[model samples]
Target chain A: MRDEFRADLHIVSQLLVDMAEAVRAAMRQATRALLTADRKAAETVIAQDAEVDSIYRQVEERVCDLLARQAPVASDLRAVITALHVAADLERMGDLADHVAKTALRRHPSPAVPAELRKVFTEMAGVADRMAEKIGTVLSKPDADRAAELDRDDDAMDDLHRSLFAVLLSDDWPYGVETAIDATLLGRFYERFADHAVNAGQRVVYLITGEPTA
Target chain B: MRDEFRADLHIVSQLLVDMAEAVRAAMRQATRALLTADRKAAETVIAQDAEVDSIYRQVEERVCDLLARQAPVASDLRAVITALHVAADLERMGDLADHVAKTALRRHPSPAVPAELRKVFTEMAGVADRMAEKIGTVLSKPDADRAAELDRDDDAMDDLHRSLFAVLLSDDWPYGVETAIDATLLGRFYERFADHAVNAGQRVVYLITGEPTA
Candidate 1:
């Protein structure tokens, strides 16, 4: 029975890692769509969001089944509960990526990101991408130290997010209110994607240390 | 043991209601601060957010305890899991209110919302407030029919959010990009607050019906 419980827990962990990967790929494609105005890439990200949601639902069902059948306690119980939280954060990350794709599609042929601001967004996307990747690594290994690194990556994303605002608010910004609004929402989408990634990392830390990260 | 589980579940439900009330009050204060540029009101909302977070932590701990001790199955297990999800949504609702308050503080004595756009924000706040209140109602009663009403309220919020962009994009708009960015983000904060409320309502429906709401 103990062996079976451990196996179930492992399955849950692997499912979370799969979710992280899907979210990472989605964000990468979404960023491509934004940078190049690739309609096909945007459409792919928007459509594949359902696949991420499907994985999230699977995680929930598996966790519920484990709890009902095994009645996992102590660290095991924490692991099961944390899986639910991690899956939720990853699901939201996928949605953020979809939001980015939709934003790109909203402008269609015209780039959602202005050329002047594209560098900052590229940096933001890179940071978010790294954070999502780290989320997968941390989930697979359950390393508290590795999970702590996502917080630093989140800081980098924040710096990029602020830089995005600086450009938007600059005296020379020629993009009218519509473009400014689009950029504002786009920046928020990337920033929140990082936030949710950090959240998932924290849940992993909590699972390992039995102590919630502040 | 069943009786004990029932008692504990009741406590969790009541805590969710308290959280709903706290979030509703925080949003109300936040909107007041945004419209009036009242620093004190903004400060109050920011400070009281800790109280909401504390309640959220309490809910997490209680749900953990319940799961470990009772190992509830079937409908009982669904109720416990839904409590955790609902608590999370309510906690996020608190964060959204904090975001609104901080936006108001960023602009200080000048209103974060322009005088012309105040009516739309007021309408948005009203829809959000009503949705939060309805979350408490649905959670307490576990009525799927009542929970479904939050979806309609969310549609109203979406309309107000769109109308806000129309105002910002108007040719006669005198406020520049900085104000536009602030309004855009503030609009998103209120819109997401309603979204979370709708999410909470859906969880309640899931709990009662044993089917996830689409």
Candidate 2:
């Protein structure tokens, strides 16, 4: 029973890492769709979100089963709970990527991100991608120091998000209100994706240290 | 021991109800601040958000304690897990309210919402207020029928959100890019608040029915 429980915990940890990787890929493809207005890429991201949701459901069920049958205590219990939280954050990241994809689809054949702001969006995506990668590492290895690094990546994403607004509100912005609104929401999506990644990292930190990070 | 566990479960339920009410009040004040440029109201909501966060932490701690010590199975386990999920949703609702308040504060002395869009915002707030109220009831009583009503409220909120974009994108929109962006984000905050409330309601429904709601 003990060995089986340990194996189950390992599976849960692997699932979280897989979720992190999937969300990273989704955002990457969504960024591609956004930058180039690729409908197929957008559709692919939108369609595959169901897979992320399914994985989230699986994590929840497995956690519940472990709690019921194995009754893990202390750090093991924390690990189980943390997996639930991390899965939720990763699932939300997937949804944000889906939102980015839909935004791309809404303006199909025309790039959702204007040429002037593509650089910042690209930078934001880069930061988010790095953060997602770090999340996978932390989940897989449960390293507090590595988890802490995501906060800096989040700050970088925030800077990129603010820069997007500066460009949108710039005097030379020619896209007008409709595009401005879209850009604002898209910026928010990327920023929130980074925020959730930070949250997932914090959960892992808490699971390891038994202390919540601010 | 069983009796103690039941008492803890009861306390968790009450905490969820309290969170619902607190979030509802915050949104009400946030709307007032947004419409009338009431800086004090905005500041009040902003400051009181810590209370909501504190309550959320309390919920997490209590739920974790329950799960660890009691190792509740079946319905009892569902109740504890649902409490965690609902508390998260309510905490997010509080954050959305805080966001609304901050938006109002950002335009201090100037109404964040324009005169033309006040009615729609008011209606949105009303629907959200009702949804929050129902959330409190359902959390307290665990009635599937009452919990299911939040979906309709969410639909109402989505309609209001759409109308907001319609007005913002209309040809006669007098607000420039900055105000438009603020309104867009504000609208999103309210819409997401409703979405979270619906999510909480569905959790309650799942608790009662042992089935997920679509």
Candidate 3:
């Protein structure tokens, strides 16, 4: 029974890695579409969301199955429960990517934003992408310290987000309200993506410490 | 052992009820702040989030303890896991309320959103609040039919969100980018809140039906 449970735990970890990677890829596509205004890439991200959603469902079912079949205890139970939350977080992150991509599709052509502002948005996407990668590492390795380090990326993203808006509010912006809304939504999607990644890292810390940290 | 497990299950149900009520109250506070731009109400919602987070922690710990100690099987295992996921969702919904209240505080003097727009937002919040309540009932009762009905509310919220945005965009309002961002973010928060509540209800359905549905 113990060996079987351990094997099931290993399977759960692998599934989490898969879910995280799938979401990271979707985010990458979404961000690329946003930066380049690539309609095809945006459409691809939207199209592939169903794949991520299905994987999420499978992971949830597997975790429940493991609990029913193997009856995990203590830390094992925490791991299974954490897996469920982690999958949900990743799935929502996927939805955020879809949001960005759909918004990009709508805003494509006619140059909605200035080059400098576009650079900042792209950089913010990079921050979110790196955070997503760090989340994958945290899930696979359960490294609380590494998770904490990656967790602070949200603060930096927040600073960039504010700067991005300050520029928009300044007299330099000429593209008008439509462009501003697109930029604002893009900033928010990246910010929220980073936030969920932070939440994932925080969960790792909770799992390691057996206490929920801020 | 079976009877002891059932007792543990009962405790889990009670915890779900408690957490759900806490989140409902928080949503009410957030709505009051939005409607009235009441700083006091916003502060109350922000302050209450800590309690919501703490209750989330307590529920997680207690559920994990039960899983570890009692070693629930089959449906019992599903119930505990569902409770864990649902509690996390409720906690997140509380966080949304905090976000809404914080946004409300910043927008105080309530800068000129039309009555129609306000009405849609109010309806969205109400749907979210009701959906959260319904999920709690489903958790305590394990009623699949009621869980199914929650999805209808989600559809309603989405419709309102669409109409709200159309009104915002079609208007020739001169308030500029700030108001647009505020309106969009408010709409997104309520939309996502309803989404999470839908997820919670879906989880309840999965627990009872042993099948995944849209």
Candidate 4:
């Protein structure tokens, strides 16, 4: 392997890991904003998304340069292409966190989740954070076994999403329609954040094995 | 243009046009299913997404072939890359319609939207269908001017999405929690459907002008 090309690959992979960590931090802050009505935290998450976007665009340009310069074929080419897709997923995970933060900012000083829904969203946030952490791990190591675990990890988020529905469906539900809408949107943000992480993991596994991935 | 490469590009663009049309029809059918409680229509919409997925994969492969064989740079390379992005948006648009259909199928005989909210979903579906139609037209012509029109079109869908909130927030709201959850999900599907169309339009503009669209 040429030392320079190896360096390029290393930087690309490392940037993705950095982006995944950024996504996790944003989600953690966004969750705090949503749970505690911390407007500052929400604004911070939203502001930080621009940095993620810039890094995403930079990674995109680097991939294009490598493709044009190296003209890589087969598995090497797959690595570059898969990196593009995973970069996109990481960018979107950041956007999902931004969405959560915006919800918190919009509701400012008032909890997006009513008292009843707080515990479930908190759990959802925890699951999403864990998934984000795993994306970084899988990116650094490209472990097919560890990458496969994200799907099962996401099932817990889905189950939490369903529980949110169950509560909304229950006759004893006391919240008004505003609360219902906030809860629904907040739940979806967490669910999709995990899905993007799962997507990134799948890309890692595909890059390692040259298998098809969603 | 070389005769063979021209033929390949033609096929790729045509398939996207076809996929865009399929997206429109799927959303139309899903809206019918949701509004009329037609399980058959919902199933048809769900099943048709597979076709969209196949076409998307084919487009991707063709783009890779073109890039490798043509080694297109500058505007030509942008066209190939932008096609990949547009194909993704089309695939996701199909998935969004499928989500709407699944919601209908899940509710079975009961309409997903309560009687009062039916009018709004109908309007949202109409906006989505119109946007999908525009995507087909833009793909065929590559008209940068026409591509910019999608931005304003998406705003209408966003407005319709907000209206769902108005009804939900109303003190006179008569629906149960199930209805609230269903309405929220339905609104999101249509909103995202339009957003994907807008994304495709942005790609079209970028391909034509080599300018950033989003």
Best-matching candidate per DockQ: 1
Quality of candidate 1 docking, DockQ? 0.88
lDDT of 2 by residue, A1-214 (tens): 8898899999988888889999999999999999999999999999999999999999999999899999888788888888998999999999999999999999999998888988999999999999999999888787999999999998898888888999989898898899999999999999999999999999988988989998
Q: Write the per-residue lDDT of candidate 1 for residues B1-214, one digit (tens) a residue.
A: 9899999999999999999999999999999999999999999999999999999999999999999999999789889999999999999999999999999999998888888899999999999999998998887777888899999999999999989989999999999999899999999999999999999999998888888888
**DockQ comparisons of all candidates to the true complex:** 0.88, 0.84, 0.62, 0.58
- What C-alpha lDDT values do all the predictions have? 0.93, 0.93, 0.82, 0.86
Per-residue lDDT tens digits of candidate 1, residues A1-214?
A: 8999999989988999999999999999999999999999999999999999999999999999999999988888988998999999999999999999999999999998888988999999999999999999988777889899999998998888888888888899998889999999999999999999989999888888888888
Per residue, candidate 3 scores C-alpha lDDT tens digits across B102-209 of 988887767324465778887888898888889778877889999999889999999998887776677575566677777788888888888888888888898888
Q: Is the docking of candidate 3 incorrect, acceptable, medium or high quality?
A: medium
Regions of candidate 3 where Cα sits further than 4 Å from its true position: A109-116, A209-211, B109-116
- Candidate 1: count the clashes: 0
Q: lDDT tens digits, residues A26-122, model 3?
A: 9998878877878899899999999888888888878878877877777788878888888888988998899988987887864445686987887
Worst 10 residues of 2 chain B by lDDT: B138-147
Q: Which stretches of candidate 2 lie over 4 Å from their true place?
A: none
Candidate 2 docking DockQ: 0.84
Docking level for model 2: high
Full ranking by lDDT: 1, 2, 4, 3
Interface root mean square deviation per prediction? 0.6, 0.7, 1.6, 1.6
Cα-based TM-score, every candidate: 0.99, 0.99, 0.92, 0.96
Candidate 4: residue pairs that collide = none
Model 1 stretches with alpha carbons more than 4 Å out? none
